[model samples]
Structure formats: C-alpha cells, structure tokens
Target: MLFRVDPASPVPLGDQIAACVRGAVAEGTAGPGDRLPPARELAGSLGVNMHTVLRGYQKLREEGLIELRRGRGAAVAGGASPGRARLARAARQVAEEGRALGMADEAILGLVRAALAAKGPPPLPGPGDGRP
Candidate 1:
C-alpha cells in the first residue's frame, strides 16, 4: 500500500493517513483481504508517531473497512470494494454537511430517501462501472 503523510498540513496526521487509505480503497489500489503494513513500519516510513498510524487504522476499523487482529495486524474487511468505499465516504460527507446546516438525522435521512425515490432504483452496474 502507498501511504503518505504531510506533517506540515493543517489536517491531523491520523486523519491524513486514514484519508490516504480510504482513497486507495476507492481507487481499487487497495481491496478486501489485503493486509496493511504494520503500524510501526508505516510510522517509521512516514516519520510519524506510531500511535498516529494506529489511530488511523482504528478509525478504519470502526468504519468496517478493516479488521484489527491481536497479532495479525490490520487487514481490509470483506465487501469493502472501491465502489462501496466511495459511497460510504460520500454518505458521511453528506451527513456531516446536513448536520452542519442544523438538520436532524431523521430530516437528513428523509431527504436521502426522497432523492432515492425520485431517482428510482439505480441502474445495474455495467462492466467497469466507471465510478470515481
């Protein structure tokens, strides 16, 4: 896996790391069942504190994108393909924006439901799907 962190960026290092992994998953460079580099190794390579990488991995774990095993390190969870990862990220962003605008959870969900209803069922994906 290719992970990069910018210590100078305003974004927290842990968040940056998590974002990189998420982007890779969204782009198909990382896929289900793939094992991530050990936290210490990644921390050494990125020149960041080991705990930072762990935090990022923990975040991904919470998102159901990865599973952390006691001695097995972290491995991408099953079913988190590029398309699903992208959708999860987009849904989170949309929820956050709605909350920032003082929308309640039910209200946001209702809007989503309305939008989905208007669009009807999504067309079956074709070969390659071509989503970004």
Candidate 2:
C-alpha cells in the first residue's frame, strides 16, 4: 500500500495518513490479514513524526479497520473489506459533517434513515451476502 501526505494541506498529517490507509482498504489493495508498514518506518518515509503515523493507526483501530498488536505491528481486521471500508469512510464523513453543522445525533440519524428509506429498509448482512 502507498502512503502519501500533503504537508501544506489544512488537514492534520495524521488524518491524511489515516485517509491513505482507508483508501487502500476501500480499493481492495489492502485486505484482511495484510500487515501495514510499521508506524516508525512509515513516519520516516513520509517525513512525519512517528506519533503522527501512530495516531493514524489508532484512528483505524477505532474504526475497526485495523488492529494494533504488541509485537505483530498492525494488520487489517478480519471483518474489514472493500465495501465495508468504503461505507465506513462515507458514514464517518456524514457524521463529521453533521456534527460540524451542529446537528443533533437523532436528527443526523433521522436524515440517514430518510436517505436509506429509499431502499425500503435493508436486512442485516449475513454469511455469503457478498458484502465487502
């Protein structure tokens, strides 16, 4: 997977790093069980602080996209897949924008529900559902 960041961007470097990983996951280039480059190495290569890369990894961990192991470094979580990663990114963007707009959680959820209503309700995905 490739990691790149724009130092001049208004966005934090850590967030940019996280976005790169998310994009890789969504593109199916980095799948479950794939090991991510060590934070220290990635930081060196990207010319950012190690903690910055770590913060990015932590964000992925929070999103359930990747897991940080003691000696094993980081790997994509088993439940993570291209489709799920894509939707997860979209969901996060929606929630962030809603919060930035000062919308209440219920109101935000209601909006999501309304949008989803066009599909007439979705059943929970199960095995062999082909969601990824």
lDDT of 2 by residue, 1-132 (tens): 988899999889998998888999999999999999999999888999999999999999999999999999999999999988898799889999999999999999999986776476566667677653
lDDT of 1: 0.86
lDDT, residue 101, model 2: 100
lDDT string, candidate 1, 1-132, tens digits: 778888889878998888788888999999999999999999999899999999999988877888899999998889788887787688878887999899999999999976886587776556687742
User: Model 1: how far is 55 from its true place, Å?
Assistant: 0.9
| Candidate 1's TM-score | 0.73
- For every candidate, C-alpha RMSD to the true structure in Å: 8.6, 7.9
Per lDDT, the best of the predicted structures is 2
Global lDDT scores for all candidate models: 0.86, 0.91
Q: Evaluated with TM-score, which candidate comes out highest?
A: 2
